[model samples]
Target: MAYLYYGADARPAEIPDHVLAHVKVVAATKLRRGESFMLTWRHRGEGTGGRTSLWMQPSIPLRFVFDEPEPEALDSEYLRKLANEATSSRGIVLEWDDEAIVGHPGEAPPIDAMAA
Candidate 1:
């Protein structure tokens, strides 16, 4: 599992490593362009239901921690999908099933160093 630590409070949003990889790409791209938007994701935890959304800004603190030591190749189709959503009024939404974004562990090669 991967954890996205957001804000000064360090509120942790649990995301699968594969899905987080995609989110990281979108988040980094937006933040680099000085864009602020909302990131919403559905909860996958046992007792947790519904979803969560955050106002993502360049000024705020955000960290993406992955259990995997190395990065995985990114999915271009998924990346395009996320980028389009991010520019929309609805902003970006991360689905739990998007974990299929990357191949498992050694099954794939590493992505860009920036994504690491």
Candidate 2:
């Protein structure tokens, strides 16, 4: 699990590394344009399991820590969708789906399996 240390206080927001990578890109693009937005995601794992939202601003500090040594291979298709959603009233999302994640047991499925 990767942690997103947001703002000065630095509360770690636990997220899957791949998902965080996508969010990082979107946040950077929007922030560079001087746009402030909200990032919302439901809590995973054993906890209250509701959601958390952060106001992402250009000036605020954000640190993305990955457990994996290598950076994730980004999916442009997902990035485009996420970027589009970030511009909406709903803001950027950290939710996961088929493409947004690797696969069960942290291993990507074979192409043939995916096709099925």
Candidate 3:
């Protein structure tokens, strides 16, 4: 699993590839536009049993990791669907921690940004 963080904060986990693509696009767009927002995710578990986490940070200064590096761009329609979902609901989000995180896990942890 991979973890996606906004700025220096953890967002979501176990995120689907498609949704992750959308999130990247959205986050990139926001960064390009000089905007930022809160990002959150379920770092562990599934559904009601999940333990959620959040982080607050800028949109552009983000890091993405995988078993392999992800492509820069993704399908537009799929990304649009994710954006729609985010707009419709809270979407997969992150919980904020007062302490700052400046790096990602060296190994792939069972925590993906979009999988949740």
Candidate 4:
């Protein structure tokens, strides 16, 4: 598991290491370009019926912590899909998948899924 610490909030958002890795790349890219977007995701299990969203911007302090000792290689296709979704008005929604942490845009799976 991984956690994303945003702002001064002590409770970090829990995420899978692979998922956090991909989100870190996409978020970094957008923040570097001075773009802001919303990152939405449904809560795991049945407790929270509503989804949560974070307003990501360049000014906010963000940290990514991974449980694994080494960082995973990024998938370009998956990153592209995330970036594309971030640019949309509705913003990006993080979804969990068994095959890959980050879901592909279309019918095709990520080209480098096995590498990650």
Q: Give the lDDT of residue 9 in candidate 3.
A: 47
lDDT by residue for model 3 (22-68), tens: 56766665545565454555444445555553332353456655434
Model 1 agreement with the true structure over 1-116: per-residue lDDT tens digits = 89999987756888888778878988898998899888987777579789888999999989999999988567666666777878888988876454453222223444452322
User: After superposition, which runs of candidate 4 have C-alpha atoms over 4 Å from their true positions?
Assistant: 97-102, 105-116
> What TM value does model 3 have?
0.47
Question: Judged by lDDT relative to the true structure, which candidate is superior, 3 or 4?
Answer: 4
* TM-score (C-alpha) between model 2 and the true structure: 0.79
TM-score of each: 0.81, 0.79, 0.47, 0.82
In candidate 4, position 101 carries an lDDT of: 60
Ranking the candidates on lDDT from highest down gives 4, 1, 2, 3
- Is 1 or 4 the stronger prediction by TM-score? 4
| Per-residue C-alpha lDDT of model 2 across residues 1-116, encoded as one tens digit per residue | 78999887757998888788778888877888899888998877666668998989999988899999987766666676677778889987677644556322343322211110
Better of 2 and 3 by lDDT: 2
Q: Highest lDDT among the candidates is held by which one?
A: 4
Model 1 residue 1 lDDT score: 87
lDDT of 1 at 76: 66
lDDT of 2 at 51: 90
The deviation in Å at residue 77 for candidate 4 is 0.9
